[model samples]
Target: MKYLYGLLALYLASWLFTLPADALQQGFFFWRGQLVQLSGALLIALLAALLLMATRPRWLEQRLGGLDHLYLLHKWCGIGAAGLVVLHWLLSKSPRWLIQWGWLTPGARHAHQGASWRGLGMELGELAFYGMLLLVIISLVQALPYGRFRLIHKLGAVLGLMAGLHSLILLSDPLRNTPFGWLTQLACLLVLVAALWSLLGRIGRARRVTGQLEVVSHPAPDLVELAIRLPRAFTRDYQPGQFALLTLDAREGAHPFTILRQDPDTGLTHFAIKGLGDHTRQLVQGCRAGQRVWAEGPYGRFVLPDEGATPQLWIAGGIGITPFFAWLEALARQGQTRCHTRLIYCVERPEEVLHGERLRQLARKSGVALEIHTRQQQGLLDPRPLFTDPQAQCWFCGPQGLGECLASALPAGRLHHERFAFR
Candidate 1:
């Protein structure tokens, strides 16, 4: 958030510096100039950040904390960009509205030769704004099927390119030779390049590796487990709590799934997916033993404590238990028992628990105390009794409302969780 606001302030300062010194005293039209520049600079900054995240740069992923954090930031940028587009629209059309109400008269300055080019820029900008707004609306509708959502979301790249062209056409003439002018042009260039990269489907391309499904089974109702064998080691270093974007079928596109188990020697990875959505249901039903797969990532930073790190409290709700399995498996491989960690699994029913036996055995092997709470057995969770020590680190992956409730009750640095809901 600091980085985002700092960048905005920097851009605002640059644009403000370029404005006429007497801008405040120059009346409505002059103030309008300042307002439009403000809106334009901020809009460009938001789109630049948004498009950059679409590229999924590893360096950016690290700087932003993780791919999970990156997704949250990307969401905010999109929302801000959408609001700014509306602001810009109002600013652009208000003059005509004012004139219609006979409140402001058009001067000879409004009839200049450059007006034609500026009009063209405004037209293009309006079109881009509409395109973006439509996509944003589609994204906000949670009812949209995941497969259809993935397909429609690709149009974001096209809208970003449109916005870039709009920025280029509307750049002010007086600022053409200035450093700020070059900065504005650079923003447009970045937007265009990033859009093209996304449109070409180059995101996470380097980390992607081919694999084949070796085992697919259902242990519980609506639960499907996949064991895939890769031909080579992952492109990026694999971690226990990290996840991969698996392309089970090209038509359904790639979806993020937490790695339940990964064997570096054999290059075998496991994913336990719950059929909560239509796309995931398709994946569960369509998965086959010999089906080809594309795995891109091993992304995320959620990990248990090292030898000297702080003790952690692990909380998993329903399908959220997936990553903890890998953590336990990793600990077992290192022959490290008596690890200072505790895991609490919460589910509505005992039958809904995934890998109940394997989870208990792994927890015992790893020397972590395990607690399973079901609505019928233990009622809903009471987070207060759970957090006995305020200094202990807490890691939660679960339903959003419950996570938020737990987060508020924990200390600032004690709570850690990934934003798994990608949309």
Candidate 2:
């Protein structure tokens, strides 16, 4: 969030300073003129960035620390851009209300110098603005299903192209010829390319691979464990705690799932899934053994340190236990988890503890200190008692409330975690 906001602020300040001296005239013309370029620059820049993030580039994910952080930035960039659009519209229209209220006098209307494509650009920009706003509002409705949200969200690329064209055509002559004009033009070009990439459905094409589901079992009523034979994909080394966007059913789209275990010798991977949403519920119910499955990348950065000497604490809540399953299995494969490592799993019921016996077996083989806290028997977790050392490093995956409570009570830099949601 800070990275995205800081980038926006830096862009706005730099662009503002690049404005020519004479363009700094006082009164309505100056404000309106400045507003035009400022709004256009902001909208084009932000929307372009949002579209770029949609491509899910692996390098950007690494730079951002994890896929979780990258998705968070992507979501907030869209939201921030949408909000700025409203503010821009308000400022653009405020003069009319001011005039009606006699709070200001109307200046004489004159032909502008760089209105060459004014008629076309104005019409296109207005249409695109309203359309983008509608799509964004639809996207924000929590009641809307994921499919509906995705369908509406794709239209943003079309509107983004329109917005890019609008910005390129309507930039004032003063800005059109300056070095910053070249920068704006480059930004617009990138937006055009990103929009086309999105429209063509090339977002995750490169990393996509196909496999066959080898096994499926209901570990519990709501828990599913799947083993897949991804001979091509599994040839590459994958870190424990990494996940994939799995496409068991094309209609449901590729949903992210953490890799629960892996068979390096046989090119197989395992996933433990719990029905958390409509799409996930569909996956839980509709999955079949021996069916074709598609997956994209072993993505994420929730990996344990290879060389840290300090004792480490790992916490998992509900389905968040999936990643740690892979971690523990990896530790077992390496002979043992470090003596300093510990894992605490919190669940509401014994029925929801995914593969309790398997987890215990893995812990025994890996030498990890394991703790399970159930609501019925142990209530909620209080880490303060366990957090005796301030130098200890903690990695947590759980409900937001649990993370927040733990963070607030613990040492500032001790908790290391990211929300495992798009937002």
Candidate 3:
């Protein structure tokens, strides 16, 4: 949230620096024009930020907290951009409406100029706006299949290209002479470049590694565990609590899943996928041993505390337990545990708990206090009882509602939760 605030502040500052003082002193007619300009600039800036987020830059992930946080920021930017585009469109066309309503006579302050290349630019901008609106709406719709959503979402790149051209063609002369103008031009260029890069399927290409599905296991009714063996030449380094984008099928696109565990000796990366979406259901139904998969990550910053002696409270809900599984595996391999860790595993039903025996075994061997909570028996998790230690760092991976409730109850900055839902 701080990152978003800082971005908004920077945008406002840049806009103010570029806007002429006389524009504010001018009549309502000029004021409306200035408003339109401001809205357009903001819309382009938001689009530029969205484009950069699509690339999943590590630096941004780190700065913004994590990849999940970056996605949240991306979502907000898209919404904001859409709003600004709508405002700009309405303001630009309001003059004609005013004239038609007889609120202003011909050649009056609200009079609209004749159409030209500028009008064509406005038309293209409108088309791009509609495209973006549709994409954003589809992204918000959870019922839509992820593969279809992904394919349709790429149209954003086309919209970005169109928007860049529109901005370049319709920018006012006063703004063109200012520093903001050059910044705008650079932003447009970057947007176009990002769109091209995404359309070319170059995002995260360098980090991608090819692997074959060596094993598949069904630990629960809706869960499928996959073990992907990487090529012998590939040497990958990842923390226990990180995730990777797995591309099982080119048409379905890459979907992010937490790395359950990785065998160092065999170089087999494991993923425990729950059948929650179309992609996961497809993977469960269609994926087989010996199938090829492209993994393009090891991304995220949800690793354990580096130097903390305080007791750690690890809370997981349902499938959110995947990362904790990896952490326990790492702890087991290390042969020693530093801090006192407590794991509260929660699920709607006992049958939904994956690797219950493995978790119990690891907890005993690593000196972790484990508590399993099933809603059917124990009811909702009572987080209030766990806040005894003020110094304890609470790590949560679960439903957003659960995270929010725990976060609000715990001390500020003590509750840490990972963002799982990309959209």
Candidate 4:
């Protein structure tokens, strides 16, 4: 569905490219001005990508209304912008124009000696366009695996710089002549500079903090609960439903983990880790107490809203219950206990339930009904009962399959899923 939405948006926007270059000049703005508008759309697309990268998960939900939709919109908009840029180029230049301009000449010396010095500028713009194309193509479905996406995503930062350069070199006259044109140029320049900084590895380094693992408690097999003492300056904490990536080895990349508990008194960050893979399995099996760990967080936008009417329905599958634990902890800290909260935490086996006792204790204390379902005992998690009672704002985290199941069963506005795997 997301892919379809994205492709459809791109297709609709691509029609903008089909317009003749003289169409804008026929009635309203010139083709140059239309290019500026297209550039503005590109700028907006870049800003959306930035928001997707930088915003915390919990804040994103509230700010963007919902992340899944925003992500879908962002993806589609980006693809459309890429297509428009292609259209813009095709409209701007013809094969005969390239030949006449002598940009297709074999040697650099021939380009220098040509009757048209415009060849150099055209060549540079073409190079930039090709770079943007490469970045956009890699960002799509292909070349995503084997860590190429990270490198290609970084390469995407160069697109803005290239586009800005393209704008400056090609539209210099309009840039200096009109206020709107100048504003467009300035916006592109600012965004381009920002992108350069990100390329230089500056943005991600800004909000990171180094902390030590103060306590480690394995409440269940293959799961490790950690209490991390954060730095004093890192005082402004996150909401209950947020998540962060824990970096035990700063030398290595960060591992995404859900925040299970936050100490209101001391401002310590707590994370729950399930030994799912090589990294986490090692962390659970080898990491000891008092180990120094850097936390690059807190991200994620899965939260119950404060809107007094939306009854919260928490559905956590397997280790997905970690973030909800933080919710309970935060609610308890606030001293506002409500009975309307319905927690449906499910696990594969009865013994696989980590921190089950603590969750039940919190549910009992807060007057929230705790319904536990063990797949080994019941065969499957029956979603019929959970969906029968509508009017519940469902916040869920689990494997992608279960999340999709809940999404299919619930209305658009009702289901909010947080993917710990992706973002």
Candidate 5:
């Protein structure tokens, strides 16, 4: 559905750029064909963006579904709208005619539509257009991997404000006199306001849910699994496969970490993090209890029970076993504990299997058929035989290359995957 909506918005934007020039040229008071098309496109794009922001489809919550799909659509709609507006300016003779009337300055001779200072309005409009273009590009594809994208994404708000100002100053005449044009411009202004409000609202809500990270024990060398205890109002039973975004300070950016354990009885959420990335390295070194850490979401759809009724084959590679640990814990909570589960755990060295005893206990308790493959000693585990079993449902969480191997080896419907890529 999101893919369809993105295509529709793109199509509308293109159609708007090609609207007839004579209609707007004849009478600015009348509803020109170009104005009508542009207005429709603007409204559709705005509404679609709003819907994507607010709607979280139920089916998407439990599986690797349409969450990313909707976000991509929202992003593209913003880009397409900016591009169409640029074309709209080029097609209209307002640029040239304004220059002839001394509206532009000599410095604007090349870029401006008109020849004089009165044409300075064109300069402002062009400035806003370029600003919007820059913001759209950065948000759509340039900035990525959160840490790298943070500063630029923040600057997007400034670009948006510039765009709103330009529209208000230069396009006011056509907008005020024509009902459709006025409504479209008004809607754009409202979108800008709504976006700002939603951002602030999310930030405030995220701040309020901040908690303290308490170190239970340093089980592994240079590795500390912190049990972050959230406030009563914020602590809810999270699913075994979801993760939370954590930030030590409200001003700092968030980093996602999987919820390793969920104690329904105690209401404690655990995060097992190794010293990796700028954030985790700092976290593993010194982050302590009684210090506030903001947390947002129980995001991601990477679990077993939610994937429908099917016999399971759980594959874990190194620390990718985070979700598997939670799944095992969830099984214990349910108390229907015969582990008829299959686990193919692949690690580099023997010492890398940190939770071996617990896994053995889980296998014994729940009837899980356990298989431990050490690549350093025994080479890579063969996944072909696992998929040979017709009843098996393969789930993988690790490297994309490894997932691709499993995806190609298994039947399409039988395989479920959750890839942990930074970007």
Candidate 6:
């Protein structure tokens, strides 16, 4: 949220600094031009930020609180860019409509040296705007399949480069002399670099490792468990609750899944994926033993905090229980039996509950109280009944609605939740 506010403040400052002294007195046409300039600057800044975020830099992820928070910010950046595009279009084109309606008269144009270049810039800008608009719309629509959504999302890089070219060519003389212009130029260059990197399919390449699937099993109708054996030379370590991006098929792209188990002795990494989307469904159907796959990550900050003996409540819904499963394994391996922990596992049906016996075994060995809830039998879970200790911290990994409901029932800073879905 601070990052979001900082971007807004930057936009405001740039707009104020670039505005002319007689911006208002110069007439509606002059104000329109200023407004377009301001919107264009803001759009470029947001586009640059989106590209940087796409790179998934680890430092930025930590500084921004987590990759989840980064995605939230990325979402807002897309929305803001879309809004600014609309604003710039209206400001620059409304004068024609006003004149046609006889509400205002046409104003004289200022002569510029690079009129031909500016005309080309305007054409590029218009093309970029429409392309961006389509991309943004497709992204916002939840009904759009993930496969198509992912492919469409990459177009932002292309349109971003075009927008950068447009900005460089059409920048006003006054803006070109100011620090704001220099910053804008820097942003454009970064956007171009990011776009190229994305197009090259080299995102997060350094962290990636190739492995062979040793086991693929179906724990339930919609759930799949995968174990991959990496080469002995591979040396990536992951916290229990972290997730990784797996690329099974080049055309399908990489998808994020929580690391359910990691066996250091055997060099085997495990992941549990539920068939919730097209990609996941494909993974469940096509994945097999001896299949080669790529994984890049060990990303996420959802691991348990080192709060000694503080009573903790762990809640999971459906496949959201994946991370908690990892945490339980870590606890069992470490023999941390003194921590007072309560786990609430919720599912629609008893059959849908994954690793029920294993969870209970781990809980007993680690001295944790476990509660299983079946929606059909027990109805919805009420967190109010479970909040017996005010000092206890609650960790949730579930649907957004469930998290929101629990957050409302608990005190601020007392509840932490995992956000795995990024849009």
Report lDDT (Cα) of residue 298, candidate 3: 76
Q: What is the TM-score of each candidate against the true structure?
A: 0.94, 0.93, 0.92, 0.75, 0.71, 0.94
Candidate 4's C-alpha runs over 4 A off are: 1-62, 65-74, 92-121, 142-148, 172-176, 204-206, 264-267, 276-282, 285-290, 307-311, 419-423
lDDT (tens digit, per residue) of candidate 5 on 49-146: 53334333334433325233334445555766666666655545454565689874323223332234335545655665676667667666744555
Cα lDDT, all candidates: 0.83, 0.81, 0.84, 0.65, 0.61, 0.84
Considering only N, C-alpha and C atoms within 3 Å, which residue pairs clash in candidate 2? none
- Candidate 6 segments exceeding 4 Å error: 20-24, 231-235, 308-310
Top candidate, metric TM-score:
1
TM-score of 4: 0.75
Error of 2 at 313 (Å): 0.8
Better of 2 and 3 by lDDT: 3
Worst 10 residues of 5 by lDDT: 106-115
Candidate 2: where are CA atoms >4 Å away? 1-6, 20-25, 108-116, 234-237
Better of 3 and 4 by lDDT: 3
TM-score of predicted structure 2? 0.93
* Ranked candidates, highest lDDT first: 6, 3, 1, 2, 4, 5
Residue 217 C-alpha lDDT in model 4: 87
Where is model 2 poorest over a 10-residue stretch in terms of lDDT?
230-239
lDDT of 3 by residue, 1-423 (tens): 676577667767877886566755776567777788778877887888999999988788888888888898899888888788889889888888998999965555332333366777887898998888788778877567777778788899999999998988888766887766777787788898998999998888877889899999999988899999976443356888898889999998888899998887777878999888667887887879998899887788887665467888999999999988888888899996744888999999999998899989988888888989999998898889898988998999988889988987898889888887887
Q: Candidate 6 overall Cα lDDT vs. reference? A: 0.84
Give a tens-digit lDDT track for model 2, residues 279-367: 87877898899899988987888885673888889999998898888888887887855778899999998888888998999988887
lDDT of 4 at 353: 84
Q: Every model's Cα RMSD, please?
A: 2.0, 2.2, 2.7, 6.5, 6.7, 2.0
TM-score of 1: 0.94
Give the Å shift of residue 372 in candidate 3. 1.8
Candidate 3 ranges beyond 4 A from true positions:
1-4, 18-24, 106-116, 232-235
Candidate 2: C-alpha RMSD after superposition: 2.2
